[model samples]
Structure formats: C-alpha cells, structure tokens
Target: MNYILYAVPFFFALIALELLLDRWRGVSTYRFSDTINSLSAGVLSTTVGLLTKAVGLLTYTLAWQQLALVELSAGSLWVWLLAFVLYDFCYYWNHRLGHERNVLWAAHSVHHQSEDYNLSTALRQTSTGFIFGWIFYLPMAVLGVPPVVFLTVAALNLLYQFWVHTRHIPKLGWFEWLFITPSNHRVHHAQNAVYMDRNYGGVFIVWDRLFGTFQEELDAEPVIFGVTTPLASWNPLWANAQFYVALWRDALRAESWWDKLRIWFMRTGWRPADVAAKYPQSKPDLRQFVKFDVPLSLAQKLYAGVQFSLYVLGGTLLLGMGDKLSPAQMLLGVGWMAVGLYALGVWLENRAHAKRLEVARVLLNLPLTWLAVQLSLLSAGPLLWALLLGYSLVSLAALLWTPRTAVGVPA
Candidate 1:
C-alpha cells in the first residue's frame, strides 16, 4: 500500500505544526516517550494489519469492490461529492457507537489512553478494529461505492482526524460551526463529566451539531483528555485490553450466562451489581488529570525502549514475512506473536500487581527467543548463540540487568 510513504511524512508535518501551534497557544503538554509510545502502538497496529491482510482475514478485494461501485454513480463530480458526504455520515455513527458499546470501547480506548492531548495521540489506533469495524462501512459496499474510491475516501477521512487530536488550536469561529475543527474535537477527547461522550463526528462537525452531540470548548476549565478508567501504563497492548479484561472478569463472575454476553453488548459502563458494587474508579477530573512522568530513570527507559524496540522490530519483520512464507508458516509466526502480545500485556500489568508475572514475562522470553532463532532455521553458530543469550538473559532480567533497577530500590 506504500502507506508508510505518505503517512509518515504527513504525520511528521502535523507534528511540527502541532509543536509550533502549541508554543503559540502556550500549551506545553507532551513527553518524548509518551509520543514515542503512541507512535510505537501505531506502528505495531500497522504491522498487525499487514499480517492479517497477509494471512487472509482481510482481503484487498472488498476495498476494490467498494472502489468499483463508486465509478457506477451518475454525474461524476456531484455524485463523488455526495458519496463522500454519505460515507462520513456512516462514520459518525461508527464513531459514536464505538464509545457506547463495551467491546468497541475496548478497541477504541487505545487511542484515548494518553492523558496528554497532542498530535501523537491521533496516531494511536487499535489493531483489532478490523474485527466488526468493517460493518459500519458496509452500507457503502451495498450501495456499490467503488471499492477503490471507498478506500481512498476512508483514508482521507482518517487523515482529517489526525489534525484534530491536538489542543494547540483554538476554535475557529465560522469554521467551528461547519467543520470538525480542533476545538470541538478537543472537547471530544476531554474526560470531563460534561464533555464525555460528546462531539462524535468524522470530517464535518455538522453531524455532531445536527445530532446535538456537540459541546463547545469551555473557557472556565481546561480539558483533561483520557479514558474513564485509567490505563496508567506505557504498554500499548495493555491499553487495548484494559476494558476487555475487565469485561471478561465480570463475565466469569456473573451468575447468569446472559449477563456474560451482555457485559460486552451493554452500555459501555453497565455491569452486574456484584461487578458494579466495586466500580473501577470514578471518572477523574480534568483538573487532576495531569500528565504523568515515568518513574524510571532516563537510562532505564532507554534500555527498556531499546529492548522493546527489538521486540517491535521482530514482530514487524515477522509480519512482513507473510508475503514470503506459506500460509501455515505465516500462521505459526502470527500465533506465536499473539502469545507474545498476551505475555507482554500480562507482564506489564503484573509489574504493577504481581511481581511474579513480570518475572515470568522475562523468564518465558528464554524459550521464546530460542524458538525465534530456531524458526529462523539458522545454524547455531557462536555469533547467533551469543546474540540469543544476550537477548534472553537481558530480557529475563530487564528489571535487574539494567544499571539503575538492578540494585535494591524497593520490593
């Protein structure tokens, strides 16, 4: 798709623009690793999509069909414009329902995990959105929107969204009324009680204005952006699963089986009494929802980032292999990747909850790393052995192997 070609440059341009605009607005609310984390998640998501497309879950032809349908409409320019409008109308519902449904919320929440409002937040999207998200756009499919045109418009709509993630821009008076300007979208990102679940739109703010979902940005208080239940972690995988794990836990605890299914289908926050009795936490005030600095020392973050970067590259390379490898081979690599994602998510959470799980994440890496090398089917030369040993030992003792976290700080 050469998405990296345009998407990368487009992203960097927005980032530069956001920084300049932030300085102009006197809003300084960005961190290096957090921005990197958001970008990393986006990269991971892109890789996963490539893998799925490779493995055949996502066929390219549906998009082709959607594009071909667009060509059949009468009166070229006017019909294309109408098709674009209709497509956005469908997107508005999809975006709204994403917030209303628990399952969809789980997937969508990844983008909102960051408390900081900046351009990088826009890059963060769920890898899992391919599941059922296509349904919202099916109307275009049924209406015979050319698969190619549909794909192009969808990209344009998404690219439009990237500009709205920043808090740098003030409300454009007339523009605010007509389009999904930065101001209205900032309110959408806000966790404030009054602002939550409002301003659901894709390209045009008119949809939100027309539907009464629009809330103007307030001057009285600043907007605090994030989810109702805080992720409070750096791991991208956990960010995607936080709500989902809660739903699963609730489902298993529910006495009735119906409640189990309903946990996913019901209102985003609805839960059985037993599950509801101890709410996750009350929504945080935007005032108190300040940015968090990672407690680790700079050197540790570098070390961690480096190690994490290797895993990311490994995953990306495996995904890229889908074109070269047979389906069975691709599935084997992807299945192991699924295991790796689960392990990393649990490992990060366990660091906060149970030390053992964190340790297990490292320990498990020994065998996993070996498997990665073995699957490469390369000879166990001294160099390869040394590399494997280094990754395994360091990854296993990542907490201890690093200079700072190595010694006693606290248990």
Candidate 2:
C-alpha cells in the first residue's frame, strides 16, 4: 500500500506542530541548519533507497520461494500479528548489532548525528543501510511470511517510530512499560555513558527489558544527544562516509595484519592499540559540550529555507514517480539531488568557497535540465526550461544580495 508515501505529509505536519508546541512551552529544540541537515540526509536516503530497496525485496522473495518452512497465508490475522511481533524481534537484534558493530554503526550512525532531538530527527536516516540490513529479516522469510505481509508490517514498524523522536513528549506511565515511548527512546539516542547502547527496540520496549539493554531515564542526569565523537559538519555525504573513512584509516595504520583484517567487525569503538596511540581522538567532555553552529544572516537563513523547500518538493515528486524511471533516469535524479544537497551543506557550514560552489551549481543546472529533458524525465517545453533558468537566475541574485561574511569559515 506504500504506507510510507501516504505518511509523508503527516510527518512534516507533525514536525510543524512540534515547532509550535516548543514555542508554546518556551523551549528551543531545533536549530535551522541542523534541521536542514537532518532532512537532507533523509532526502538523500529516500532517493538512494529508490535504487537499493530492490536488493532486499529480491533477496526476501528468493528466500521465501526457495526455503519456506510453511505456506503462511497473508490474509490470516494471526499470521499478521505473528509477523508484526517477529519483525520487531528481528529488528531488535538488527538495531542492537547496528550499535555494537563497527561497520554496521557506520551505516546506522546518521540518525544519531543530530545534536537536537525533535520530530525532524525522526526523519534523519542512513543512505547505506541496505547493504546488510536485509540479512536480519531472513528468519521471517524462512518462516514463510509472505513478502507482502513482511513489507507491510515493516512499513508499519517504521511509521510507528516517527513520533517517538521528540523532546516535547514526557514519559507516559504504563505506556512506557509496553511500547517505546519518547522518554525511553530519548535515552537510546543519548551518547552518555549511562544511556549508550541501551533501548534497541523499535515499537516494543520489552525486547530491551528481556535482553537487559534497557535503562530508565534518570532525572538526576540529563541525556546529551549525539555521538561521543561528534559529527561537526553539515554535509550529508560526509556524514555517511565519516565512520567508514575513520575505520579505513585505522585499518591501514594498524601494526598487525589481524588487526587490519578484523577491525571492521570488532566492537563499535575498538581500535588497534598502536593506531590509538598514534592518533589520539578527542572525546568531548559532556558537561561543557557545545552544539555545532554556524552563524547566518536572516536573508541567508531565508534563502536556505527556500532552496531546501524546493528540494523537498522535488524529492516528493521523485518518490511518487520513481517507479516509472529507468536506472539511468534514477541515477540522474540522484546526481541532481546529491549535488544540490552537498551545495546546501557547504552553504550551511558557511565555507569560504560556498559562493563559488553555489554559482557553479546554479550554472550546472542548465545542462542538467537539458539532460533531464532528453531522458524524458522532464517535458521538453520552453516554459519549463525558462522556469528552471529563472530559478537559477533568481537564486544567483539572492546569493549576491546575501552577506558574504555571514558564515566566514566552517567552524
């Protein structure tokens, strides 16, 4: 039923509501650049998923057809209930291992990179989780959960998680005992020593309770969001690659061959002794930790907001029409999205070169738009081309009007 598609507007609407609720309560839980970066990662993830989701679907279908334990009817309510429970059971392990293992954490860490906890944080996701996440669900396919049932329940499980990413919601008494309430899930996102690697369940909190990974949120200690080793930049592409690059560098520097071979699979933060000694990484002191920010003029902030809104609209269009696209067309869409997002990141970081890069991006849109028409992804009409040209020119005009000193250098 493509439930995720149907929920898109609701997701943004709730985020808007959360913003209003925050203002009413007189607390700020969102930063403009951080929210933009979080949503950019989500946009990149969804756009990339259009290409990679087939891998899991194909693998699940193959396993279900070749090695079914029994023929399970998708129509049965009992079967649906069982699949729902079992999917969360599998998700518990998938999510637990994602935090515990180095390579897996690399793919899963994007969701935790946001320093602020709000509804937009719920939408932040990884672009690369499809690589190994499919294997965790093989048991369902083996139990003969039909692909349709598995897919529907999986979407439901994900949709159920969206609302729990906020700081606006306080703990519910008995509800916290059963499902994953916002309070419990907030602890899961914490980088504090007391809360790290706990509460790995999606919809249900019982998995954590049974598995002994659950920790109650303490009033004495506030949860500090984000990874211990902070993601200080706003780049979506770099956010996905940072951990991998860190591991790769450590692997190359390791003194022993075994260390190099096994580093990727070792416990989440493990590093070779020699590599650790040579490259001492700074872990922030949580008591005095500061959130990453870059100053922007009001015009610059408005310009960024306008550009991001266009990307969001463009992304929604892509998601709706993605099935009709050829691989080449999809790749083209990806390229367009990636470039726009990366440029936005540069602008957010207030890099000295942002102006040059943005100018190039707008100019490049001309050729990219022509290619989109040739690929039949866009209609070949003068008005459409003129609108594209007009957007670029308008953006350029806005850029020129914006103060160059607003964000001097990437902090």
Candidate 3:
C-alpha cells in the first residue's frame, strides 16, 4: 500500500516542528547544506526504489509460493501479529550484519553519513539495499506469511523507526527497557568506543537484549553522531559511493589473490596487511572533531532552498504517479532529478565550476519539460510551458546575480 509514500507529509511536518523546537530551546541540530544533502539522498533512494522494489517483492512472492510449509490466511489476526514480530526479528540480524560486514556496510552507511542526528537523518536511506536485503526476510516467506501481511508489517516497522532519529527526545525511563527508543537508538548511531556496534533492533529492543548487543545511553559519555570515517561532503551520489569506492581501491591494491577476493566479504574495516601498512587510514580524533561545513552567501542559500523545495515537490509527484508511469518515463524523470541534485551538491560545495553547472541545469529545464510532455509524463499545455519558462528565467536571473562568493558561513 506504499505506506511510506502516504506518510511523507507527516514526516516533513514533524521536521518543521523539530525546527521550531530548536529555535525555542536555542539549540541548532540541523545545518542548511547537511539537511539538504540528507534529504537529497532520501529522495534519490525513494525514486530509485520505485523501479527496484520489484526485486524484493518478486523474490518473496516466489519463495512463498514454492516453499511455504502451510498456507497462511491473510484474514487471520494472529498471522498479522506474528508477521509483525517476526519481521523485526529478521530486521535485527539484517541491520546487525549490515554494520558487521564490509559489503553490507557499503550500502547501509548512507543512513549514518549525516553528522547531524535530526528527523532528516531518518530519511537518509540507501538506494542500493534492494540488492541483498531481501535475503534476510525469506524465513517469513518459508513459514507461509502472506505477501500482503509482510508488506504491511515491513512498512509499519519502518514507520515506527522514523520518530527515533531525533536529539530533542530524552530517555523514556521504563519505556526504554523493551522497545526501541530515541535514547537507545541514539546510542546505535553513535561512533564512540563504548557505543560503536550496539543496539540494532528495529522495533523491539528485546532482540538486542537477548543477543547481548544492547547498550544504554549514558550521560557521562555524550554521543558523538556520524560514522568513524566522516562523509565530509554534501554530495548525495558520492555519499553512497564513498565506501564502495574505498573498498574497490583496497581490493585493487592487495598483493594476494585471496586478499583481493575476500576483501569485500571480510569484516567491516578489515584491510589486507599489505594495504594497511602502505596506505594507512586512521579514524579522526574525537576531541578535535568538527562537523563538515561550506561557506555560502545569503543568495545562494535562498536559491538552494527554493530549488530543493521544487525537487521535493517533483519527487513526491513522481512517487504518487509511479504505478501509472512507464519504465522509460520513470528513468527519464529520475535521471533528470539526479543531475539536478548533483548540481545542487556542487553549488553547496562552492566549487569553481558550480555556477556553470547550475546555469546549464536551469537552461536544460526547457527541453526536459518538452521531452516530458512528449513522453506523456506531463500533460501538453501552454500553461505548463509558460510556468516552465517563467521558472527558468527567474532561476537564471538568480544564478547570475548571486556571486560565487565564499564570504558567508554555514549555519
């Protein structure tokens, strides 16, 4: 039923409320470039999922049809309850292995890339998880849980997780013992020595407790958010590819064939002895840690905010119409969106060629709009063309007037 799609509005509303809380408490939890980059990763993940989700659904459906021990009735209340619990149990291991294994961490690290632990951080998801994530849930299919029930519970489990990714919430005393809470989840996100790989349950903390992987949040040792290897940039595409690229480079440099082959499947951060000795990489000093930021002028900030708002709107529309669109149409839309996001990332970085890239993006909108209309992705009309022309002209003016000045600092 695309439950996450339906919850998009509420997600943004809560983010807005969190921003209000930040202002009232005089605490800043979101930075402009960081939040935009986080949301961009999320938007890209959701858009890519529209085309890739079939992999998981089809595999699960085939497994249920062929290997079910017994046919489970979708109408039975017990089936739903059991599936809900079971999905979380599977999710615990999938998430745990995602942190423990190198190849899996390459995909799951997107969620942990954002240094700021805010509501926007929850939306920072992996676009490539579809490749291997479905293997974890095959037990439910084998036990004869219906596909409908599996989908619903999976959505509910994910929906339950969104609210736990904030810093404003304090520990819920007794409530913190059994279920996943904000405090415990914050510990899960922390990169501290004490908190590195603990607390991996999706809905039930009972799984972590039973498996000996739970850690309580401590006031004496405050959580340091983000991964050990900082992402250090606002580019969404690079954020997803950063770890994989590192692993690839390591694999290429290893002297042993066995080391090269096993590097991907080895434990997270395990490098060949040769590679480690030659190209050493060290975790940043916690005491000297500073959040990654880039300077931006006021005009640049306003332009970025307005452009990001448009992408959010466009991405939401694409999601709503996903079922009705052709694959070609979806590909074209997603491709254009990706280019726009990359340009925005460059702008945030204040790169030398950012102005030219942005100007190209603004100009490309006209032909892309015409292509979309011709492809039946958009309706043919004069009003649409007029609106596109007006937006491009305004965007071009802003791009020209906004000097490529690095005077203003990130908020």
Candidate 4:
C-alpha cells in the first residue's frame, strides 16, 4: 500500500523538478489558482476514490466477471501480459469516449480543468468515472481474462500514466510515434482548439496518431492550458458540478425539447442561441493569467502539505493491507481515517492547532476500528463505550467553539 507513498511523493518531487526546469527552459508553469484548486480537487477526489473502487469491485463481481471467456492456455505471465494489452485497449476506448461523450466529460473534465499542467495535475482524477468505466474492460473479462490478472494490469497501466502528466519532458523524437510521450499527453491536457478532443491514448500515442487525433505543441501558437469552460471557483465540489450544471441550465433554457438534449452531444462549446449569446466561449491566454508565487500562509500550506502527504502514505498502506485485513476491519479503519482527516481539515481551515487532540482521536479510531474488524471473535461493547466517551468529549469541544465561525472559510 506504500505504493501511494512512492507514487504521491514522486509526483511532488517531479512537480518541483518541473518548476526548476521550467525556470531554465523558460516554459511558464505559473497559474494563480493552480495550487489551491489542485489541492482542493485532490481532497475531494480522494474522498470519492474509495467509493469508485467499491463500484469497480461490484461491477466485476456481478456483471462482467462472466465476460472473462478466455482461459489461460499457458502460464500466468502470458495471462498478465495479455491482460495488460487488453486492459490498455479497453482503456484506449474508455479514454477516447471520455472525450467523445458528454456524460463522461462531466466525470473526466475535473482532470483537464486545471490551468497549470504539472505533476499535481496528474492526481486531479475524477471520482465518478466508475459509472461507465466498467463497460470499457468487459471485453477483457469476456475474453476470459482472469480477474486478478485484469486488476493487476489495470493498476500497472494506470501507473504508467502518472509520469506522462508532467511538462518537464520534450517530445522523445521518434518515441512520440510509439509511446504516449509527455509532449503528446500535453495535447490531451491542452485547451487550444486544435488540441481539444485529441490524444486520448493512455500508454500509446500511436492510438491518436493512427486515429488522426494527434496534435503537437507549436512554437508559433503556444498551447494555453485549461478547459474552454473554466472553473471560476476555488471550491472543488463545484468544479465537479460546474459543467454539468451549466449544461443543465442550457438544456432548460433551450426553446425546444430536442435542443435541450442536443446541448450535450453536440460539439463541446455548442449551445442554444439564447445561452450562446449570453455566455460566449472563453479564450484563455496564459500570459494574462500566470502567477509566480503561491502566497500561502506558512501555517495553512504546512497543514495542507501534511494532510496530502498523509493521504498518499495512508492510501498506499491500506492498498497493500487489503489482502491481510478483514474487510470489516479495513472499512472500520478507513472510516476513522476519513473522519479524522476531514475533521483535521475543518480544524485547519478554522486555524485551530489542536495537534495533540487530533492525534488522540486518530489513535483511538485505529484500535477501535481494528476491534470492529475482528468483531466476529472480539466483543464490540468496549469499542462502543470508548467511542461514546470520545464523541462526548469532541461534542463538548464543539459546543465551546460554536460561537466561532468554523464553517465560514477564513482567509
């Protein structure tokens, strides 16, 4: 599970590296809202990520686990390799449709909405993709790709996608023709008209090149980053809903019912005459929007950094711990972690520094949730009694702080 530790820190290290390299190479990586928005999205996405994993598990077990029609004629290595290729192929279609379809865009646009393209942008994934996502890999299951092999390959393919999200690397010359290079994937993240809806390949750029969706970053018309419909708010939850809601409003505003549905499937920027006349397509110019310094509070930045680090570390640990722990115990532990992290976040937002109290809450949850996990053998009475006492203390503290504005976001 420390995979998150390796992957998440590596992401930040590369992000810092990219900034340094950007200074040397003179590619501007500055965008004012990038850090805050990226971090906010990261928090929201992490909260929802667990829910999607459950959805994936349910889908595989219930629906298309039957689709795994092909048997492994040889050993496990062959099956794993084939699963890798098949999963990538399925991923290719999933990615391609994410760009092609509107409903999918609602889930996926969170990743592309960032104005800055960096390693942090790689972590800006959607929590809602599991809805239609299960469809992409059904072919593999039907072809008889074993569940374990399929899951492993899927994770590996995802791991491969992480590095390409950075802007530090130039096109790998001919390598661009085969693999999905940073250059090509940048097109996937770009907001430029030519770059929009292009380069959907996950591990292979050849898919785009073969499919005629490939575009290169040009010196003359430098690519401007972010969506055509920019996320104008710092609230990450709103970022997930912005486009979908906009589409909904436009659909409602349409003069005809057919025009309502047409707003989605039509070209991305297409809108009803009434809607189009009121809010035109936004053209983002990086030169006008770049901000060099993030200007975060020493306290807030440090707190956010700590929270993000913990999630990445804790997520990786839990991922590996999955096989060893009972599902009940894992769920119990995760619930405590989630609540503690969010409570820590709310406290941090309010500029409250109660680290010792926070630590106590976390430690309390670990043993309690652990007991909850082993409930078959262990009695729940002690755990319940302890939880009641902890809740009472926390509730009293909440009562004392009720006069202060903890919910209103502070500057």
lDDT of each: 0.69, 0.93, 0.93, 0.66
Tens-place lDDT per residue, model 3, 1-411, is: 789889999999999999999999999999999999999999999988888999999999999999999999999999999999999999999999999989999999999988889999999999888989999999999999999999999999999999999999999988898899999999999989999889999999999999999999999999999999999888889988999999999999999999999989899999999999999999999988888888888888899999999999889999999999999999988888889988889889888888899989999988888889899888855788999899999998998898878532232
Better of 1 and 4 by lDDT: 1
**lDDT (tens digit, per residue) of candidate 1 on 99-211:** 99989888888888887888888888887877767778777765666655666677778888888887666788898888898889998888888899998888898998888
Candidate 1 vs candidate 4: the TM-score winner is: 1
Question: Which candidate comes out best when scored by lDDT?
Answer: 2
lDDT of 4: 0.66
Q: With candidate 3 superimposed using the best TM-score fit, by how many Å does residue 249's alpha carbon deviate from the native? A: 0.5
Residue-level lDDT for 401 in candidate 4: 41
Residue 256 of model 3 has an lDDT of 96
What overall lDDT, based on C-alpha atoms, would model 3 receive against the true structure?
0.93
Single out the weakest 10-residue window by summed lDDT for candidate 1. 402-411
List TM-score per model, in order: 0.77, 0.98, 0.98, 0.72
The better-scoring model by TM-score among 1 and 2 is 2
TM-score of 4: 0.72
Across 175-237, the per-residue lDDT of candidate 4 in tens digits comes to 888888788888888777677888887887777777788888776766677887677444456
